[model samples]
Target: MDFTQAVEIAKHIYWIGMYLENDPFQCHPYFIENGDESILIDPGSMLEFEAVVRKVNTISSMKNIKYIILHHQDPDLAAAVPEMEKLIDRSDLLVITHSRMVPLVKHYLIRSDYYEIDKHGHQLVSGDLHLQFVTTPYCHSPGAFVTYEPFTKTLFSGDIFGGIEESWEFFAGKDYFEKAKPFHAEYMPSRDIFNYALTKIEKLELEMIAPQHGSIIQKEKIAGLIEKMKALECGLYIEKEYKDRLIHTIEELKEKDLALRASMQEIKEKEELLFQKAKMADMGEMIANIAHQWRQPLALNNTLISILKEKNQQEALRSTELAEKLQEMENNIQYMSKTIDDFMHFFHPKKEKNLFLISEVVRHTLEITDPMLKKAGVSLTFEISSEEAVEGYMNEYMQVVISILHNAKDTLLHRKTKDPDISLRLYENGKDVVLDIGDNAGGVQQENIHRIFDPYFTTKHKSLGTGLGLYISKMIIEKNMDGTLSISNTQDGALFRITLPRQSKTGKTDATQPDH
Candidate 1:
């Protein structure tokens, strides 16, 4: 429970989050020491980056951080990713997350390629390290998920079981569920969605629940906590609107006095009936999605079994080949049979395309980059000359902006510019929107300008730049958004311009864009 250093809660799991006294919402970032293939889960916000990094370094080197598991897109759990990736200094380190989270999480301008759990069969195997992911969409966010380590029987439950406690501890006591209920009531969408996530957790051979916030739940308290969460009145049922209305109605009935008791009884019965009907409808929809998600995996497992039987009958089955096939089939069957109930919810309505203001994207991007700029004593100026709307991937566009700003920041700092400055201007050009970002650092050399967008080309020290930033930025702007990314040198510095059509021509809804 000590927050002074990394606490090994399990054999290989370490609690590496920062401790802020009396803070209701404390973030917990965990580190798993799997030798060289160690993993960091929910690396936390920029505020805790230094503390988290120091704690991680105490037990293991940053270079050994092979995978960063992002539970969702919230800044409290993800904003430090860009900075952490730079410090980890491993080119092969990957950000493991759900495919539905790729769009938003990518806006942090992460350099490493993503190992999307949904696309990669919901499990990862590297060296002797094995991780299974569980989808728990809408337990908070649409792409919300959790990581389960079978060896330790520990579930990294993200915000699903997280609490807001004024007095915090590393491990949950019996009163943990009461502390966690308020968070679920405020953040979760409905009790049914929460119960769906609980059902998934119940299926796992869970010994502990290491969530992104609050205390970690031990095995002895796990079952009781799950049941309490299942029957808890949270989300829509206990939201301010519903609670206030119910209270007001009861108060009016009490004022009337004549049929107060009868009316109260009738209202309670009607409310229960309505809630049951709604819960049933929600459950049916969940069942349908589960069936849809299981179909492909089930079919594939069946095909593998058929192939195995035919090979055995023909007497052509090599022992090694048969063993591999059986293992593969077993994995498939396990996935299909015990799949996360809301796995298909990644395709929920939240992922659909919608119009977004260009100004808002710039604002959100600055909210992250501005702090870094100030810390480095670099001045930043921005202008929103137009209120243009772009019907493309807003988060992806934000990534493009962040990537450019990050490069500029590095360049200015590396050169030791006396009065470093970055300027941003967004305006409408014909039917397209144009964004111009310029920096006061010396302009790119003529020879390097042509090759700037080339992959693996860098004018930076080996550790400072991967040369992938400009390359991927071009790909995201040109290929994904049907836009153009071009650069020109002003009298004082280099200026990067991004031009995009106001409306999306491809109508692409896929959040998982190609990394290249």
Candidate 2:
């Protein structure tokens, strides 16, 4: 069936493209009429060119078709160029496209005048209709663009927003974005590339979106589609590691489920003993940690006092020297105060759920731990690939980082291996934001790996071991925050990866904002 139709999208604009009965998405070709001039957009393949030309003839004369606007150089869009040239029957017919796409279009239709779009895109005026070409590079094509007609409040979007559906309606009812999500996720490169293009497109007062494939998006659904595009983690953003990480996480969760089931009865029976032991351990551990952290600063303060006393006794303290020493003391006091504040923050109970950038909190945790790591000759490195927010208790999250870090630091000291190094990396894997903390010391023993997170399981000396740290950290991450915390041995050392579901970058104001 020729089944060709002339569908009017705006006042002088028409979708005079032939419908593809066999093609699943039913690619649409549009026609824009401008007084004595006309524009043909994506005239379809050679097989459909004659049918499309015939369709256009029924509505507008072929002689008025002045230009063929190409958003990209895809064969589906430009395959008809050679055949359509025979149809145009005029040498003055100009092809509009980006310069990079010129060679491919020339290969199809030779000896044609080309109107190239610059980096900022091109503007083409057709009678009463003013068309603005907006560059949408990597919107599934290297040199793709969306034609925006301000007068009609319409956008001739080429594959930027579309979906595969059964029916071939000219305009989709309203569920366009929802239906189109899967297609975009598969086709579009990433949200980063779409962000700038979407910003430009959203600024326009658009009434309708006529895409080359699938149905059109119109009315209130325009904003919804734009918003969806803004946050979509598409093709380029999907990590190959995500699958393995997810599979491993599922196994860990199953094991934990079984362990928790078996341990709950024992935990309940020893509730009072558990509480007292936890309290004592936490108090002793942190207080000893405070001493470990404050040793250098305390020694430095004492040395400064001794120098000042000696200088005063000799009457050799100059004004400048006194100022310099006092500044040094002030800096030491500030650092000591900051260390206390960070540790305090770790212990402070979170008041409410809120969005927090875990990277910043992790950085602060590193700062509090840096002193001890340096003192123990353990070098620490932090790399944040992508920082995004997660909805949860920030203080609790900080404690988790601290707990894991302390474990790594202690292991490094315990092993007493030369040139100890800890590598902390924070990245996102499409579905979750992952924080992977690995070390250079020997990895976990295969035997002890399974029991690492168990409550009251200790492998350290009685003076230094609390075993409750990992248990408490696991509770804070999995039970309280809906995230996964797993540890495994790597080639160099042990790797502890915490996977948290990504949340809005600008966290919600459900809780009071913490003082900076």
Candidate 3:
């Protein structure tokens, strides 16, 4: 067990391996031999205490050990002190650690004389070897310390530069950087401790690094490694040259996303404008129908009034006939008042589904569109079916009718035919009510037929059309009112047809106007 060897530095200094070949605990102990006095640095584990004593026996010959320098109180480094004392008989000086580690070292090595080393530059002189203790706490443990020999410039770093691996090769393996990087990152207890220790070591110009569990380093690599550890300990978010490039990329993406959102918003606004235009066109057609409805009643009322004025002065005027004429005039006035009510309700904006007479909706829509049709010199015709009670949103249904009537009126006006005619037909088909509107004007263009219902797609002049009319009308009838609308270009003109369910899809019948 002669595990001691002296390197030719200044005096006889021996390096001893307590259990370098063992499985669990492997430590290297260095002995500084100066004439008669000796200093032992980290004397191996408790299990290898017998081997260390035997090895020390071969060199000293006297069973007396002078001093034991405990760098750290960790078991793997300084665990054998209690057992070593029993074998050797001498006035041994136990150079213990800092005040923080006194409790731990005292718990294990109870009878040994303790000497505390505090502060930065503390030295222990044992003949030729002057052991300068550098306080480097928090590198791996709270009571961690590194011993530097000023004579040989050899640093006994406890676990600061140590890494895990059983290989005897001192420098790390082929993938040294990769293996050593995580050993410090994952296993090191505190980053603050590592940083504080690194700052203290940077001031030292060391030539050799004899770590506790690993091989010795004696070049610029130790300093370089400590520099990197200091950088990591401070903070992991150090700014680099590539940070600007990443920021620029993020800004570009944000700008692109903003542009896309703006484009989508513009498209939505355009769609809404088109729907408004369609509704206006429908309103115009409704006005023409209203004019047609009021024409006969108003004219007849005027004629009756004129005749009554003339009869009032005539001798042939009789009381019986006067009553009949007066009663007839009263009926006409009541009819006109009813027409006004229908007109008011139809023009009102808020329109949702409800139970109402189909005939009233038709009459109100016609009243709103009649004036426009008459102004355009388009003749109106109506073939009303059975006067049945239907369930739906009144205004929405009227809007559909208005859109159809307006399209017919526009066709007739644009055609400028000698005989302009627009016809409205209503009938019951199975369980649904169907309305068909036709005109004697030229039909829509063949190529533009399919695009009639697409938003912003219109065949009329841009100033006269918003292109949303048909699209919105289609949405109102199909989605809101749960009805269907269709169009066809016939021989004479364009025909628009609409079908509505007798009962609402939701099965709830509303009898009032719906909120728009």
Clashes of each: 0, 0, 28
RMSD (Å) per prediction? 36.4, 18.9, 20.4
> Candidate 1: lDDT of 340?
58
Give the alpha carbon lDDT tens digit for every residue of 338-400 in model 1: 545223321131433568777777875675455457666788877766776777777657656
Task: List pairs with backbone clashes in candidate 2.
Answer: none
* Top-TM-score structure, candidate number: 1
Output the worst ten-in-a-row residue range by lDDT, candidate 3: 507-516
- Which scores greater on lDDT, model 1 or model 2? 1
Q: Determine which window of 10 residues in candidate 1 has minimal summed lDDT.
A: 507-516
- Which segments of candidate 2 are over 4 A away from where they belong? 1-3, 119-121, 242-516
- Candidate 3, after superposition: displacement of residue 157 in Å? 1.0
For model 2, how does the per-residue alpha-carbon lDDT over 1-516 read when each residue is reduced to its tens digit?
234567787888888666667666667788887644788987777757777787788888777788888888878888887777776777788888888788778877546688887743489876667789988888877878889888889899988887776666667766766667787888887767878778888888889988888887886788877886788877766665764676688999999999998899787667546544654665565666678877778889899999999999999999899999889988888877877876676666676999888778877777666656777787777776666898899987877787787788888888887898888787779879899889987988899999999988878887777788888778778988999999998889999999999986543222121221
Q: Cα miss at 338, model 1 (Å)?
A: 66
Expressed as tens digits, the lDDT of each residue in 1-516 for candidate 3 is 223443322244455664355342246666666545566778878665666666566666324466777777788777787677666555664655666677888877557677677742477776566777788765566777888887777788776676555545544444444434555665465466677777887778787777776555656577666666665622222234444665688899999999999999998797667666776665554455566767888899899888988888786678898899889988988877786776666667565457866666877666566667767887887777645556677777777777766766666666677789887777778888778888878777889888888877877667655667678878878877778888898898888888887753333322232111
- How accurate locally is residue 128 in candidate 3, as Cα lDDT from 0 to 100? 62
Once fitted onto the true fold, the runs of candidate 3 whose alpha carbons sit more than 4 angstroms away are 1-11, 18-25, 61-64, 119-121, 170-182, 231-516
